[model samples]
Target: MKKFNWLLMVCLSVGFALKAQDNSMKKLREETAGKIKNAEKDTTGRLWKRGGNFGLMFNQGSLTNWAAGGDKLSLSLLATFNGFANYKKGRHNWDNNVDLAYGYVNTTSLGTRKSDDRIDMTSKYGYEIGKNWYLSGLFNLRTQFSEGYLYPSDTTREFVSKFFAPAYIILSPGIDFKPNDEFSLFMSPFTGRWVVVMDDTLSAKGSYGVDTGKHVKSEFGAYISATWNKEIMKNVTYKTKLELFSNYKHNPGNIDIFWTNIVAMKVNKWLSANVSLDMIYDDDVRVFENKETGVMGPRLQIKEVIGIGLTAKF
Candidate 1:
């Protein structure tokens, strides 16, 4: 009876221990489930939206004494990013956007050279005033990331621009018409624009409309901006912007123009292609050679880039 009592006691103890362990595990699981549920909840609120895309592209070529002479080894790489965040609550709305791109190419003979570089950003806040109309204030910036050079020949290059050598800043209080999610038009009677050439070399040369030996210039202008973004078809999207500015105190009839376009085509979940075109004209910036006239003066500048590569969206 003593032995039997000992065995019975030990079995009861084991059973209680097992039951305690199971209860502990069940509590832990419940806590984890609760945490996961809370994490899945939208903490940013329904009025806010955010998205972005990033791309990396590359090209490579090798020629081994073929009939057509070419570089023995050639490689190029390009990276790009575009992002936006928007908030709309009641009569108030705010929008922020950013764009960045850089590219370089290397060849057996030409060495390495910059092929593309850009930086653009914008922020706007608005309050609804009437149907499809809002009183808005906007801020914009444009600059470059690295040194730019003009290649007069395959063996010679002249430094033209660099980081902050030519930076543009614009601020305006405007009326915005936003009819839908895909289009926006903004107009301001008076806009403040600043052109900055921070580099000593570029400042002394009066680069980018800045006065010689001066670092900055201020101008008041009338500004008009229009933007459109939409998915035109399945897996293809188009985005564009057009800007017009006229200096009120200077040659008002000589309106400056800036236009940009981007087209993105989604090939699959991880592959993509893109094309971009940009044009700019400023009356005071006189350094480009006209293709037709072959003269260095104020000329329309156009740039285009096309690439196919890997992409990520978030």
Candidate 2:
């Protein structure tokens, strides 16, 4: 009788232990599921994201008594701002971006002059029509913030460009291929581009391929653009964009090219190093050659900048 009672007691203990373990596992599963549900709710409910970065760059030099020749006093300052507003929900997407940069330099031999100037803005909206493809419309504008001058050694500064003197506006209805957030390609066979010369003097001079005395010139064209951005490594990022436009109304064989690339490296919380390059070629825009030969023709334009600067993100 006692042996039977002992065996029964052992069986009861095993059953109780198994039941306790099962309850513990069930409790853990419920907790994990609750956390997952909260995470999904938090992310799906958010609609808009906005962020930007600001940078200030400076260069200065002074020479009083130096073995090598140098300027007495030189200083330069550059300010840059880049920002974006992006919205995504369901099958709709909208993105807007702005970039503004301006810089000036001064030297003992030369007076203050503009080193760089640019203002670019783009807005695009898309509705999903197929896998990784969207029917889209885009608006883009590019111009300069201040006046520009030509500095020939023998003569005084001659006005070459002013704000809105050669502003560009592009509107296109296209198909956007966005495989991911880091890359995009857009194409439009029917595109309208406007070249606006707001300054009367520049308009009268037929600046930027516009007819003499014309304030605005319009062209129908085909447009293609691609953009890519990626983090090369920790704390380093690279971005590039390429744009092509062929005017069907004019020289459709001669295409316009605009390309830009930027590389940024973070040094710390408030300091960074950056390099930027821009290249442009437009067939209709003519540049003056040597006065002795008196030749004028279209030419490629390029700009490059490298600097270490104070940066802020918001």
For every candidate in turn, the CA RMSD to the true structure comes to 4.5, 8.9
- How accurate locally, in lDDT, is each candidate? 0.92, 0.91
In model 1, the runs with Cα more than 4 Å from the true position are 1-43, 290-295
Q: What value of lDDT does candidate 1 attain over all alpha carbons?
A: 0.92
Q: lDDT by residue for model 1 over 1-314, one digit each (tens)?
A: 99999999999999999999999999999999998877666545567899999999898999986888989999999999999999998899898999999999999999999988999999999999998899999999989999999888999999989987788899999999999879999999989999889989988998888889999999998999899999999999999999999999889999999899999999999899999999999888888787888887887889998889999999
Question: How displaced is residue 200 in candidate 2, in Å?
Answer: 0.8
Model 2, 1-314: lDDT tens per residue?
99999999999999999999999999999999999999887885577778898989898989988889888999998898999898898889898889899999999888799988999999999999998899999999999999998876734888878788889999999999999989999999999999999999988899899999999999999999898889999999898989999999998999999998889899999999889999999988886575677888777889998878899999
Model 2 lDDT, residue 71, Cα: 82
Best by TM-score: 1
